[model samples]
Target: MPADRDVLLSARDLHKAYQLGRVDVSVLRGASLEVGRGEFLAVMGRSGSGKSTLLHVIGALDPPDRGSVTLDGQDVFRMPPRGRERIRNRDIGFVFQFYHLLPELNLLENVLVPGMVGRSLTAWVRQRRGLRRKAIELLEKLGLEHRLQHRPRELSGGERQRVAIARALLNEPRLLLADEPTGNLDRASGKAILDHLVELNDGGQTIVMVTHDADVAALAHRCVHLKEGQVTSRHDPRDAERPVQSVSRR
Candidate 1:
């Protein structure tokens, strides 16, 4: 860890729960963490270990019942509705296990959705050409240029995942949150996706990935486990009891 390491995201004492029928299931219990700029960190745990819940809270998609999440020093949950939405759109990118692509839209059109967001009809029209160019370049980078006109239903699982990655990157967000990006694909396709993530991280993109596979977690610069709602480093016994784990690139 560098002395000058910049912390881009901070979650302090986070707590979240869900009501399942008559039961209240607590997922995150005082979980906290810090992610540095230009770092690729992986959160690992067992099934239903609240890894996805942690990502959702970090990305500002779900608000925690207790504690605060700050991105770039701004408290996300404390912001206004529009402010939080802006951060989600412009500062964060998300890639899910299911590659949530629009089945009705082509690859290019789907990638353009982020750019079209928060823009008026006239504004979108003025920016469409440039946004289209960027989207194509992203598709080309992801090896999906030839499938630009292809719909999600027509493409293979890997191809759809690539397209979804391109869409998440359309806005050039500062943070990329991936939840089980390789869980649905075979080993080869999953390796390809992880390779892309490694390349992106090498280029200084910050990423927080959640996975249960230790092999997948090994690809990141650092790995932290979510146990009892708190992040702990298996490599460091001291971190096992700490509530807040500030992980930095090794």
Candidate 2:
């Protein structure tokens, strides 16, 4: 969280649990965080620290067992089912490590998925042209202009990840939540992805990225460590401001 900017996202005393067979697994226990407007923050933790679960709850993808998540000024959990779905579609953008692109769809079509969701056929027809232009611009900006007609299977790992990012930005979301965005990429590819993320943050796109690697997390403006189901540390690495990621290969 940046100290001088307005708060854009806030999670207060969050608690989330999962029922695994007969066992009750508590994932988040009173975890709280705040992100300033246009801030890029990273959450770093080991496996099973519930970083992904926290992102889902805040992004309206999953409901928390207790507590609340507020985006801008609206309470996320208090919204109706349709409203929350709308939030997921229009308010928050998600970039996953796996690059969840539909294999059958081409790059151009894949980027347009968010705009087509929750729209009537008539509405889609009316808005498709503008959305198409926006998608083209995003893809081109991400250096995918030549691959617009290509399917996911035809692209490289970095190229596929770029398509995922373009799709996430199609709706012009208020918050972008990335889960292990560089986890599956090679060192060079991972650094390239981080560079794009840095460029987005510079353009005032508020982002919350989750990663286990400290070097990858250092790319953010501020880093928080989630330990034992809660955020227990906060630091800003003013030294490593460049997009150089020295992540270890797993």
Candidate with top lDDT is 1
Model 1, residue 173: distance off in Å is 0.4
**TM value for model 1:** 0.92
Residue 61 C-alpha lDDT in model 1: 96
Query: What does candidate 2's lDDT look like per residue over 135-236, in tens digits?
Result: 999999999999999999999899999999999999999999999999999999999899999999989999999998778886787778777678855433
Cand. 1 Cα-lDDT = 0.88
lDDT string for model 1 (107-199, tens) is: 999999999887779989998999999999999999998988888999989888999899999989999999999999999999999999999
lDDT score, candidate 1, position 81: 90
Model 1 lDDT at residue 130: 93
**Residue-level lDDT for 66 in candidate 2:** 91
